[model samples]
Target: MNAPSSLALAVPALSLKDIGKHFDGLEALRGISLDVAKGEIVALLGTSGCGKSTLLNIVSGLLPADRGELRIDGQPAASFRDWRRIAYMFQEDRLLPWRSIRANVAFGLEAERSRRAERIVKAEQALRLVELDGFARAWPHQLSGGMRSRVALARSLVVEPQILLMDEPFSKLDPQTRAQMHQELLRLQRFKNITVVFVTHDVEEAVVLADRVVVLEPRPGRIRAIKPLDLPRPRIPTDLAVSEQVRQLRMAL
Candidate 1:
């Protein structure tokens, strides 16, 4: 075999090659191939039932593809075998009502077999990462929607995942809070160099948050369009370019 290219040496954080998925005779995705580089944010943009969430599940390894290949960090997905390197955040906060915020954040670490003391330390650090340290002892029901989402994000980050898969994590938040979470998410992703692939139906959300917006075709979704955005950081939604990009993406869909 020839030597690997220098480009290949810089392995993508996650990759899917012609991945397909079927559920109960329904084709959810087909010929899905994409790549996410470390420190990049990519969004799967489409309407409900377009398999955006299904694709996210496959990338996170929570759901298996019926066909095609996968690779993580330049290694075969099956052979790489370190699930700890990936973390997922869903639309629901899914925090345990009985557990404290600190405990909820530390839950995954426990799954990783981290020691109680160490789990607490890392969970606190993760909370700090999301600016929720003061709320560690609080109960899940005590938080606002945005705060709960922050806790969920901290939970995902506590394990130090190299890739974060979000399934419309901010979808339930109010408009203003959703915008704030978008900013915080970008800041955290940049600070941690964590690769992110999130699914969103909201066109403006995709334009505002993703480095690239991938529009998926409806039912048995396939890549419809991949639009790269070069907006400046702390993106202004009302900016002409942003408005135009959103308009274009809406048109694309």
Candidate 2:
């Protein structure tokens, strides 16, 4: 395996060094460092208050770290001008109840001030990517939980982001639906070769979706371990290797 320095030379998609954050003197994170390779899937795994979301928010530019350096594509985040290359999906789908699915998917592009025609085309393409092209006219309340999740994903992808940040986006789905979403995400990630960083408390979800899992400890949250998974694709929860890996991660947490 190459050393981190060697990997750094290749220009990680996202990088953080000694990243720290606090909320009114309560340290949420400390010495949090990580490098996410281009097109790789990395999961920030930990319980509540462990700063997983905090770290993600910092990377997304929603919140600034109290102390640390963040780089995107080798450019210091402060100097990085391509904010549109990154997109975030929160735990809630946050789909507009008043808008049609296509309109909601096109919402991401509204900030770019693109022509309405172009946004519609891009939104349609994204909906097709998520297998929701048929639901363009449907409303959020008309879809199932899984379908709603797909709509949320379509909205995120409509921007054609190079890096995607998700905060427990599928945590509310049923087991079957969640597993489906996992496959959907992996498929989309592979197809687009998009780098992904997500926060999750699910050991099995992390084991299934992440190329690497960064486990964190709470109370001034810090790294506990960074484990890389080299398992085969479509890692079923019942498979011995997958189950064992999940068990180990659960133990670590």
Candidate 3:
């Protein structure tokens, strides 16, 4: 993949300034500030109740921060008109049982009210991107766990999002399948040059995939440390350097 252009490096794909969120009387997130560069892969690493998912929700425009500002592609998120440029994948696959794999992949386009033929074409392309074109007509229940995850990923990518937010999307997969998904995600991200900010508690996963890992502390979750991983690609967990990085991240958490 080519290096990010100077202009792309200049403007952040996602920016949060002193972001704060509250639920009832408890503060979920506080003083959270971050900038995700275009085509960069960032991981939010933390234990439960550390607001990793909460922060993702705010970035995805599903929840509003009580204080602070959010900007997408250099514009204030509240005023950002190109919301279609963002797509989110939650923890669960969340594929509708009733819909075929192709239909499920096309679900995101429903909000745009596109014609059925156009949605079908785009959905097919997305399935092909995830290497699941053959299962287009299959039901969600007919696929394996890993295949379902790819379908979920295909659903997210069908919209051609510039920024993809994931909330522990592969946490449920077995170790081997999770590793495969990690590679798949990296390949697609490189191909699409999509900026990614994903929430993950696994130190190894974060170290393996992130350009930078933002560790958060619980109880009004706040940034504890930001570690940039400058390691080489295809970072195997068994490798000395990669294992050391994972060890350090685990210590931080």
Candidate 4:
């Protein structure tokens, strides 16, 4: 497995410089800067109201930054709107209640004007990738929490994006389920070779899942520190060194 900071075949995926956002007179984020290398899994660790979601929204092009510059794959973010290259998975599954799992997975592909047959084919392929192919015909309500999460993940992957933005996507799951999702995430990220920016308050989650954990100070969010985990893959939280790393991460936060 490739280490966190090691260079891979893929180049830089995303870059942000002095990025800031404000609504009315309140500042949500201030002078936040970071670069996510291609195929890197980076976690943004911060408490609630720290603008983690706001930063992700700016990166995903859902919201424009009030200040600073951004580049995606070396292209200016201002002129780039090809969102098929950047996908998002949220805290909620956000699956359409009325749609089947397969349809939900293919929902984003419709924006690309994909044919119905093409969408189903790609969606099924993506479901298989997430080990949810058997559940493609099932409804969201019919599956377990983990299964639904897998469907959500498959939905994000179905579009074959270069980067994945996850905003505490598994925070709602139980401990066992969350651990399963961690493994699933590591497997899929390695398989797909996509850059990931995962936002969460869970220190162990960030340490276990990411190559680097970027901690943000709350209230007018600013990056406090960037700690690269030099530990091995499939990080063992119970291990002495991994525990120490998590302790350090908590201290940084």
Candidate with the greatest TM-score versus the true structure: 3
Q: List the residue pairs that clash in candidate 4.
A: none
What stretches of model 1 exceed 4 Å from their correct place? Answer: 1-9
| Pairs of colliding residues, candidate 2 | none
CA deviation > 4 Å runs, candidate 4: 1-11
What TM-score would each prediction reach against the true structure? 0.95, 0.96, 0.97, 0.95
Per the 3 Å backbone cut-off, how many clashing residue pairs does candidate 2 have? Answer: 0
Q: What is the lDDT of residue 54 in candidate 2?
A: 86
What residue pairs clash in candidate 3, if any at all?
Answer: none
Query: In candidate 4, what residue range of length 10 has the lowest lDDT sum?
Result: 1-10
lDDT of each: 0.88, 0.93, 0.94, 0.90
lDDT of 3 by residue, 133-201 (tens): 999999999999999999999999999999999999999999999999999999999999999999998
145, model 2: CA deviation in Å? 0.9
* lDDT by residue (tens digit), candidate 2, 1-253: 3225575547899999999998999999999889988888999999998989989899999898999899999999999999987999989899999999999999999998679999999999999999989999999999999999999999999888999999999999999999999999999999998999999999999999999999999999999999999999888889999999998999999
Per-residue lDDT tens digits for candidate 1, residues 1-253, read: 1224478646777788999999999999999998777777899999988999888888878788999998999888788788887999989999999999999999989876657999999999999999999999999999999999999999999888899999989989999999999999998888888888999999889888888889999778899988888887778789888999999999999
- Give the top-scoring candidate (lDDT): 3
lDDT head-to-head 1 vs 4, winner: 4
Ranking of all candidate structures by their lDDT, best first: 3, 2, 4, 1
lDDT (Cα, tens digit) per residue for candidate 4, span 100-189: 999999997988866899899999999999888888888889988899999999999988999999999999999999999999989989
Clashes of each: 0, 0, 0, 0
Clashing pairs in 1: none
| lDDT computed for candidate 4 | 0.90
Instruction: Give lDDT for model 3.
Output: 0.94
